[model samples]
Target chain A: MSKQAPVIAIDAMGGDHGPEVTVPAALDCLRQYPQLQLILVGQDAVLRESLAAHGRSDHPRLRIHHASEVVAMDDLPSRALRNKRDSSMRVALNLVRDGEADACVSAGNTGALMATARFVLKTIPGIDRPAIIVTLPAANGCTHILDMGANVDCSAEHLYQFAVMGYELVRAVENVDSPRVGLLNIGEEEIKGNEQVKQAARLLSSSYLNFIGYVEGDDIFTGQVDIVVTDGFVGNVALKTIEGLARLLGQALREGFQKNLYARLVGLMALPVLRGFKQRFDPRRYNGATLLGLQGIVIKSHGNADRAAFANAIRMALLEIDKAVPERIGERVATIFANGAGIHEDAPHTTRMNRA
Target chain B: MSKQAPVIAIDAMGGDHGPEVTVPAALDCLRQYPQLQLILVGQDAVLRESLAAHGRSDHPRLRIHHASEVVAMDDLPSRALRNKRDSSMRVALNLVRDGEADACVSAGNTGALMATARFVLKTIPGIDRPAIIVTLPAANGCTHILDMGANVDCSAEHLYQFAVMGYELVRAVENVDSPRVGLLNIGEEEIKGNEQVKQAARLLSSSYLNFIGYVEGDDIFTGQVDIVVTDGFVGNVALKTIEGLARLLGQALREGFQKNLYARLVGLMALPVLRGFKQRFDPRRYNGATLLGLQGIVIKSHGNADRAAFANAIRMALLEIDKAVPERIGERVATIFANGAGIHEDAPHTTRMNRA
Candidate 1:
């Protein structure tokens, strides 16, 4: 591997399909981006067998990092953190922490991934807790939303930090000068949400970030804002709800076309148009959800992600690595704290670092 | 009007188009249901003019109830409650309170409508606060979810109450003997959500209701559960996100069909199939959201509802009246309290009635 190549550690034993999906996705990434190097972490025998099947077991850009234990999809976060230190998920995260890889990508149990990532990599200074931010296709382009289920409960200060991190991510990755940020609330009215959201809105409004007041859930798809900030609980539900709706619509459309012979004929003729429309809002194209505020880049692919989706997640990690996202986020957060513009005076001094 | 006919008070000056939509919708409902009576509440002259335009000025089953003031769509809930005493929404709600109308339907500001209805009708006995429940199209049939936006901060007891209310509503309206109830959470695991959801899950597990354990957002459309209970904030966001996704898909489909002449021809040929799919998930068909736990039936129509949508809201009110939803919900809560099945021991004794 070239010395300047960006190295990504992959959890080969993660996700439903394990090495079957991750190994192929890693190879695809390596083929697509010649400079990209990947370390596939999994059981040595299984990794060798899977790679040998692909006819390039000795590929220069790929290597195997053997891990004895594999965290089960249903494992508790605390249990995984405590007992599965040698798990593939933990070893991949350890690679990032030890500077062996520029970033890491995993399609694993979300709670366990978060726990292991937080434990091994730690959070960036000035960020209370790491958040999961994902880009969702929208009307105009796409919108990025955060806290997609890392923390169940969050404070106003934590929300404010998410806004800053989301804004910085969009700016760095999307190449926008100043991203429009919005607090996701039930309504656009000033007095709409619970105390935390209302307080966060106040904090955001006082900040120098391009803080548009409040946006409802619809605004995420309307493409009226660039980054939507919300607590983990709401964000997670909204994301899953979106997923469910998309599946429902897709199924309904398929059923509609197969209703009769004439409709099937028309569906065949309309294939290109339908495919183009589907491509525009394809979930696989928008697969990776970055765990932000961590000391190094960590991308979480959906556990059921296909090869294309997993590759997209690797692409996201590559982009974050190329953009130096963590360094930029740490600097931006430090600057915000030093300036004391958005920081609340009464904001809790305790962060996850101190608490842990 | 027949002696047994249900009387519905309509807020004629509510919604975006006011009487332009509500007056026609009222006429439509009256025409459809021979035993239905409607009182159009609004500015006297404007409503009279609207009725005259619809050639229903002398309809026996329809009458005008003059409300002197109008609540602006953006008015704060407190302001609408304090100042708009004789506003169309308030007057219509008052008609329900006075037993002059069996129910009231309003396509006005949500917060104002909620605040005014709570004040005018009060919550049913054993119920603390009112909640908004609406049915959304799902895979097999439909699923009812609450509280869509009435109570932002909810306790475990409040969620338990919502579950009971939703269960009763579905049983009465949908004719389902025992509706499956699921608590909306970030994950389906026992340790997924915050303290409130966890406590609520325990409460539900011990209750007589058909309590399925926790479900994620996608389950709402999967039709795996009959009723999904969540706090106002998450429910509202999820519902709006669904709406947004629906709109986005609709637009994308339209644009896809209009892409080229060939595509347009295929769209024309496939129009029937597309229309069938659209009709199955039409928002207008699911237009009404009942304010559950109120002493009287109060249905809130979408603020921007067209005539068809407004008429659907009226139809929902009629169905609720036929089923005596408010009375059934009151009885259900009374029985739950009597049995002492789900009520938490340390649940706050202070209800919204005392606080309000």
Candidate 2:
């Protein structure tokens, strides 16, 4: 909307579809915003071909950063970092580090992207392990959940850090001033889950976060809490389960509409409203995946993301830029650690106290 | 359809709704299967009231097993078992132990149910810890995922037991011979998850199970594997997440159909087909929760399950009784530990080797 728009560096060689989807998406973002500055990072020849094919070569603010290689989806994080020095993902991360762009966006290998961001930009001050934040489309707006697959085995300290970081994210994007944070567990009672969740609940409660009591799986979409935090393993499963079920239900709706001529007519008439309702759950509008705890902002788009999804990722990056979330999160975690709140405690110890 | 149906003991004083839903559901089950015998276990006065009001007191096969106490949903597992001696859940478990019923069904407190079953019936011959098996509605049919909140912290041996037990379940119910089993993880690669998942993967590969390597959360509903094994902490979250998403999608669909007159007409015409499709995804039709690795079959229905859901749970109990899943699973686990297959190697040592 403004002339001084933010610039986002995109890894054109990353993701399942790569430049095929990324180039068109970048063009769409530019078309919509009119002022968006995009620095496309990828191989020179391929980038040129894709840009020309989209009739986007003559765009004023569009530029290309020539990087020669790519990190494959299956490439191990550590090995890829050591081996692929000039990869597009790495170069895009460098742009953010060097202050050439406000943020970096990629739909590439999630592990590789997270590793590269941490390796290059490093963790922000007081943030221990960076997390992946997923914004789920809920009946009452989108619910932001964190640590979706970044760190698998987390300490109580790590989870505390994730909650602090996630709280800031929900406030920043959803604009909820006092975001209610819930620890994901098997039951609503504090004592009803494994040691880790109980410990995390204790840490969250003791911190400055507006911590609600333990929340079960069903609570995630109930809008009972604004932010839900967990270890990546549980969070990842929750995210995937939601996606799979949404797809399943959508298919069922289609079949239902196709059953009879009356249904077909009804389906045609209801198409606009159904589309509107579905747009709320489209996932494209909510596809931006944030790598929390990083020194800078990094957003990972879905691998099969289309133009609309990628644009949304750009919009998310802009929101983060506006909120200064990473810095605020860093300050909060530092304050907690400085106070020496609930550290040097075992999982069971925390669990017992929290359950009490 | 048969002349002489199997007998199932019901814990009427269980679940959030208790006799309010359970008694009516039992009556419905008897109606659906005229030959089925019901052994209702609860306080005599309340059961009599519900039965009389429902006009089902005249049936000759309807029997009552009086139980004075009930298991509160939030009671600690250990405390509840030691203190609530005559609880309905405990009495129900005793029926299975006393051989008075072929199988028992409860919608009681899960922890208490698990603790009582373990205490009374004991673990299957060679199993370390009994798992909780719940079927997930998948694209092809359904996949039985084990340890869906029974055993929180699992060992390599525990997962090995779950796989064997889960294999027997799918083979008996789904009729899939040599069912494919997958260890739930963050990625599909052999080395893509946390320490526990990796160790379980290694042991599963060496065992007699049809180990199909690692599976991510998304793959759970694709019907790519017949069984998915994970620790209870993760499995619980996965199951609840799926449940939440299913309910959320259903709500969204209903809301979408009610937007206007056109949409309402579409909804009207699509009702039959939508209902049919929903029947496929309904948790009620698949409402049986098996307490795996037990000496006898004990199924836990949903706490708020209505007549239809409760009937499905009873139906599942009958099928398991006929298949003799308990006896088969016990034999499989016994063979693994008897041969000293993965147990002799030591789990920690395997974990260290795999990590290195």
Candidate 3:
């Protein structure tokens, strides 16, 4: 698979901007990666018009796949799954499921996209559910957090699975021989957190993985761990809270600079430095969230992503395609299960070692 | 209660800095509010030594209440509750329990403080648990979030009770006639969230309170609602994530300004504006988290709070005392129960109106 050029399916009619953003992003990805091929799945006429708007009727690496339906941003996942089989999101996933595309990218309704993808490409063997994993900027380098908004009510066994998946992904992509994985909890104490987290902590502790016990929320940015595993509800809330705070701080900084003439002059002088800081922590730079533990690769871009952010999502899919993350996770899970260290529902929780 | 001067019990031996921070903070509070009386609960000699170090032997408004024990920051709640009866934290709460103080402020182990406060003051009638409520700087004015780190697990009925408590607190303290209440969930859609949040949403919708349905994490800072309610685990994680992101951004901005000679020169000119911006969102201004639903007012300061932040916590306790937060919440709960709008354990989930 690595020998062939990477082929990605784009949900052209998804997200707030639909084909206007995804089409240009698809073209940008093709331009950046000469060996890349993209399948734009949407209404044929709309995609063609978007492509024409970009000064191209057609490209050798790009093909338009007709998808009659488009999932609305407010569509319920179950409704989208049952009704929108011909949706751009579903068609993109179908392309990947049929092995025509190495991966798929979509800036669509997250719930609808997840439902369609899961229905089309089922979870890998020994995996109960697929989790969304995203890389976030940290003090040292970066941190990968899983179950961003996937499974809401994850069991202890499911959290253990997320840990295994996150560990393998970090090891494979970041080239970390032993990625430090931490279970996200309210406190870094052995006795903190609810029953599920405590049980998950026990599972991670007994495993061969480089588990760094319970970590509090602040640890996510402290660069104390490589991967943070959490239930989707907590992870989603944390991620969105970060976004909200970033927005708030950004607004406050802008208002401060525009307060008065002297401050505005000083802000003018500080523009370059502030821009550099902004670029360093730009949400656009970290746009893609991968659906891990699936049989195939699917990257969920932020629904409001512009061309550049959508292109970044495509870049993520290409990287995952090159790394074969799913295959590696499968092998790791298989090895752990064969060693009788995999998730066992009936297994009693045990504390083997203190958290590092 | 309003006619009498407010007397606050202080846990002087709590938090990271102990007497070094609490003593000076208590003194500053005494100086700030002429009618305020403070009781410093700690080792007699240590309190006196701290007071002497601050160029004071005693003040007319300040009194020392010596305790034989100190609760360590790492002490388990159960252990602290079972054995540390003479601990500063317990002694402070005992003062409130015995009506020696109108309220109590502690920068101590949160678990221990909550556990001891619950055991001492007990929950208000019809309130099953006490929740920690903190006011946070938001896009417009400020937003209050409850269950900050109190109950790890919450039922739908418990969440309904939280909504009533939060609504009452915001109304009494912020002076909003109808505070917009929102239940924090993964998404704003009615279909989103786990069973607990969805069930809670139904309860909120049926209530007479200005209950906005489900709210996403980012809504906390959008100033879209006055109160956001969630289980303690999610609330704690969200709050910590905000702190982590803030610290990360502050460091990044500092590093950006110090990158070069030109940047540093611009940074010097930008200092006043930056300082103003920092003051606008300073965490110290929002230091105290009220333990709502308790029979007496209890304020929990950040364990690492310095003098300014601890003083802010005292101010928060004073504000609650002035507004009679606990009394109002108790009355509100009683009214709701009298109207049969209170939590019904076996109430079937009902959706009456679409979320506004």
Candidate 4:
């Protein structure tokens, strides 16, 4: 390619639909972002056939890289790590690690993707573990929720690191000078949550981020905070809970309007408005989950993501690349640890350090 | 007094609205359940005034049981245990413990209520800790979720106890012969969740309950299982997340239809349909969390619950009493532990107990 555009690697042989979605999504993203180059890492014949069907056989900026193996969704992390050396997912990450691409997007097995990314790119210094920060559509616009399914057994220090990393992520991507970050807990009271959560709150209060004291689960969609910090288990549960409820609500709404003739007529009249709401709150729009704390940007798309959803994942990776998120997080975390605040466990709430 | 009815004790001076909501809710529940009796436990003058305002002061079926002190929401559980000897919350549970009331319902401080209940009622044998089990609206019907905000640092055995207790509660209340019980986790795979969850799954599988291997957070609203079990931290976060997302979706729907003149016209036409939808998903309808594993039945209403919501909590308590839920659980748990499963911590998944 002659243009000086950002290159993003794609795991074309990932997800349920594989190339059927990824190849189209990559092409769609290239059309949207003029200064974008794509590297499709998968079996050559499968990608070529799909690209041929899409009538994009020879784009100037698109190149196909062949990979032999694929990681199945149910494959254990250990098995994936040991078995799939030259898999599409591994190859995509390898490209990013080699500085051949600015970012990598994958819709493969979450466990495998996280394991490979952590192993390949390694974590930024002062960051103990990597986190999967997924943004969901909230009352305002969206809220960045971290540790979706990455670190299950997080320490107080690990939680504090998540809060700092999440804070920096929101600031870099959304460009908020001081993003309001809330530690997800059962209640809003200062002394209400579990030990780890309570300790993290104390650590966050001592940091530079605009830390809003313990926000309950409902605060996630209340538009009160830009970022919510939680351990992997709780965050993963909360994110999936949101997705489940959204689908349930949509189905309920549809059935509620189809019961009677009058209701059906009302549904007809309300179609435009409902369509608008659907478009606004579509899960596909928020499909991409950024694998934060890596040396380079890596976007993890939903395993069942469609073309539009996979394209959105590419857009998310592009945004991270443009803002230099990893560097920003590294600098912020260095300051946090340098102050010796994050080094201690269960720091007393009374002696919280204020950002001056 | 003439009727042979179940007597429910209400903590009239608890919760955010105090007697304003509790008194009215008690009256409303009494009105709905013809043979139901209620005891208002609170300060004498306050109870009398609230009862008189509702014009039910002299009703024979309703009586005042005076308690001098009130438990504040922010009061530490330890302080509440040490200081509030005659608080309304404690008095209500005392009625149940003394056999004067079939069940006790409180909209008081959750921690204080849990502490007071455990101290006063103690736990049923074989049950390590009490869980906050609440039901939420789902697709086919409703789903029961436990450990809403109690026992954050749960052992695998504690989680197993919760599952057995929760499973029995569903069978008694819903009358499903063998309720499908799922261990709430981040993924559906056996090796997916954190340590405690995996161990709990093993314990559950060996037991007689229809243990569904692993269910994710989204599965809660899908109505695939009658009971979903998790530690207090994850369950509480999931419950609150549902509430928050429901509120956001409601607001989004309202705003979506009120966009333009035509949209407003369509919204007006769809008011009946929308009202039906709202009624079906009303949070108040799903109010009242049952504190399971206690020797006596203790129902916890949301502290911020209104009249309808608090009344629903009373209804929930009545249902449990009618079903003899605690006694049934007591018997079932005796059998479960008799198999020597409850005592072991981190038991291997394969050595799970068989029905034989």
Clashing pairs in 2: none
Off by over 4 Å in 1: A1-3, A188-191, A338-356, B1-3, B188-191, B338-356
Off by over 4 Å in 4: A1-3, A188-191, A334-356, B1-4, B188-191, B338-356
Best by lDDT: 1
Q: Cα lDDT of model 2 overall?
A: 0.80
CAPRI tier of model 3: medium
**DockQ winner:** 1
Q: Please give the TM-score for the first chain of candidate 2.
A: 0.90
Candidate 2, residue A83: lDDT: 95
Clashing pairs in 1: none
- Give the Cα error of residue B154 in candidate 2, in Å: 0.9
Per-candidate TM-scores read 0.94, 0.92, 0.94, 0.92
Clashing pairs in 3: none
Off by over 4 Å in 2: A1-5, A188-191, A259-263, A338-356, B1-5, B188-191, B339-356
lDDT digits (tens) for residues B125-223 of candidate 1? 777778899999999899999999888999999999999999999999899899899999997253489999999999999989999999999999999
Chain A TM-scores in order: 0.93, 0.90, 0.94, 0.92
Displacement of residue B313 (Cα, Å) in model 3 is 0.8
Candidate 4, residue B325: the lDDT equals 85
Cα lDDT, model 3, residue B171: 91
Model 4, position A12, has a per-residue lDDT of 94
